[model samples]
Target: MAKHCVCLTLDFDTFSVWSAMGQNSPTPISRGEFGVVAAARLLKLFDVHALPTTWFVPGITLDTYSAVCADIHAAGHEIGHHGYDHISPAGMSRGDEIDQLRRGIEAITRVSGMEPRGYRSPAWDLSENSIEILLGEGFVYDSSMMGHDYLPYRARTGDRVVSGQLPKFGEPSALWELPISWSADDFPHFEYFRGSGLARADDVLANWLGDYDYMTKYLESGVMTYTLHPFVIGRGHRMIMLDRLLHELKDRGAEFLTAEAAVARWAAL
Candidate 1:
């Protein structure tokens, strides 16, 4: 059977993302607070559709909203590790990155009552040591890279890329790379950052659905991952668009699965 999977994943960063950027003003923090409200709305929609999705949440967000996080777990959703404080691992010291991972894992386990099988770095950026650290800590997959649009690949280690030198590629590791892309992410489309983002819901919806249609047309079996944020997609019009997306994808024969579940099925195949 042709297994074309669709994984709907959310990055529940809440206020930590703003904190990471040093934007700790009351307004920015309040903006993050809206995510809490959005989460509730999303749960209702998912329950209505019986969708099994994933939420990659930061440790701070998890701690800040422990009850909400637990509710997400209770609703039959996978909670993947996003990071401790929404700080990207790129340019971070190896020790600091490992510290972040440990904190994130601990928080996730504390709330979800299960160790996270996957990790998605904040801001979708990874350091040289991230893959190795995750593999060492037994992470099954990482969804922070964009190596492919409709397929997952092995995470690599030991790449030697430097200025004024030929790039030496790394060896593939056991860790899976459940890739992501900017176009499929909602932050850039909806979030008003640096005075720029705010796309029409219909336009963003068209782009997202178009990607799925293209993948189904070209690939016999592939994973179509759409990244969303509660604070971004939970707005009234966008929420309607999201609901439409779920039904539309269903009509298009989408078999929605959590990130971990999709990875397991893909790996087995």
Candidate 2:
């Protein structure tokens, strides 16, 4: 039977940026700063249950909440860069992208006391230029590429197409692109603005159950990444449902691994 692995990834963008560009609501709870606290609570729950998760934090946010970052590292979770200041690589020049990635490396190393082994672009909006930058900067894997749910494939830094499912670049050729495939993303589902806010606990749970059941029935193991924002999943009202989801996954014999581990294993296949 194929063993299912669940990778929990949290995009730690502070509350300040959430309101910028009017993308998120102005509500205090919806803000990014509070999002950290929300994430911390969820982390505590995961720790109590001994579930492993991966946190892809922006450099600026990690700097602001070093304590939370430290705690996550201490809990044996993997920390990867979410870029510097939540800047999208797509808008940056090649030089600027490199500079941002370099800054991300420094920030993560300083805050977490360990150099991050992986990088995830902000908003899954990595420009073709960012891949070479990641490889050049000594990053082993990039987890922003999607469309595949079960494996980590290689993608060239500057050679990807503009659209229509970015092509895979080959392993050990350069930097590996790990897919942070989402089963349920919290920000869009919980926040009214993103159009994913209508995601109720029951609806999400049912979706996951169906997906997993199908995958299990085929004896197919795939990489499933859950995008959870602290503010959405950690809310007082939503925490119950969050815990229930975790419990259900555990009961289904799902295995949780850090992004680095997942990519490493996938690369071996």
Candidate 3:
């Protein structure tokens, strides 16, 4: 039988996102607070469907919302590293990035009682040193790149790129790459930020389902990851849409897996 896997991954950044962007005003801070409300709703929805998902949580969020983070862990969901304060590694010094990684991992361990096996960069941007850092820290996978849509591959490091030259590809490392795309993420599709308009739920749903359909039809076995934020997808209409999407995916024989589990399966093959 053809296996079509789906990983429902949530980035539980909370107020850390605003802090990272230097937008700690009341309005922006409140926007982050809304994620708490959305997370509860999503947890309930996941319970109703008995779905297993992964949450990429920042260190600040974990420290500030220990109970919520604990609740997520107790509910049998995987918690992955997302940075210390939603800071993107792309702009950080290698030392700072590593410090962020260490601090984030320590916070996650404190809350979940286990080290994270996966890491997803904040803002979906990884520094050139990201792969080496993840490997050194013993992370099994990273989900911040878009090398392929439906396939998981080993991550590469040390690629050479220039303004007007054919890029030199690096050799694959031991770390796995469970790629993500903006198309499958909720912030760009639903959040009205800096003039980006909210898309109709139906339109986004159609596109999401179409991707799954294509994967089911063409790939022997594949993983489709959908990225969602609590504050964005927890809205009434979007929550309903999410529930419906889960039902539809279940009906189509989509095997839901946590990001860590998905990466393990990919590595085994």
Candidate 4:
């Protein structure tokens, strides 16, 4: 039988993302605060379904909302590193990147009493030093790059990409890459940013379910990851859609696995 795996991943950035963008105004801060409420709803949903998921949390979020983070861990979800303040890795110096990784890991360890085995770069942009830092820090997987849709691959380091030359591919490292895309991410679809209006949940559901349908029919074995943010997907309509999506996938025989578990299976292969 063909195997189809689904990883439901949440980036619990909360106010850190707005702070990193220098938007410390009351409105944005309050908007992020909604994540706490949303997380509770999501946790109840997961409990009802008995599904395991992954949460990529920033250090600031862990510090500011320690109890909420603890609740998530208590629910038996995997918590992964998501930087110190939701700052994009691509804009940081090597030292700053390393600092973010270490500080984020320490915060996670404090709450979960264990190091995160996976890292997902803030804003899905990886710096030149990200892969090396992840490897040195003993991270086994990353879920930021968009190199593939349904297959986990090795992360590469030191590729030379110039203005007008063929890209020099670098050697693959021990770190596995559980790729993600904007298409499967909730922020772009459901969140109304500066001017982007909210999308209809039914439409987004079609696209999400379609990806899994294709994976189940065509691939011999694969994993599809859907990225969600509590502030975005925690809304009433979207939450209902999420529940329906899970039911649909279950009826279709999709195997639910946390990103850490999915990556381990890939590594074993």
lDDT of 4 at 76: 98
Any runs in candidate 2 off by more than 4 Å, and if so which?
19-30, 157-173, 181-183, 194-196
For residues 63-112, write the lDDT of model 2, one tens digit per residue: 77888888888888888888876777888888888887878888888877
How would you encode candidate 4's per-residue C-alpha lDDT over 1-269 as one tens digit per residue? 23679999999999888989999999999889999899999999999999999999999999999999999999999999999989999989899999999999999999999999999999999988899989999999999999999999999999899888999989998889999999999999888888884999999999999999898788888999999999999999999999999999989877889999999988888
lDDT of each: 0.94, 0.74, 0.94, 0.94
TM-score of each: 0.98, 0.87, 0.98, 0.98
Could you tally the backbone clashes for each prediction? 0, 9, 0, 0
Clashing pairs in 2: 14-32, 15-31, 15-32, 15-33, 150-223, 154-169, 188-196, 189-196, 189-197
Off by over 4 Å in 3: none
lDDT of 3 by residue, 35-111 (tens): 99999999999999999999999999999999999999999999999999899999999999999999999999999
lDDT of 1 by residue, 186-214 (tens): 99999998897899999998999999999
State residue 232's C-alpha deviation in candidate 2, in Å: 1.7
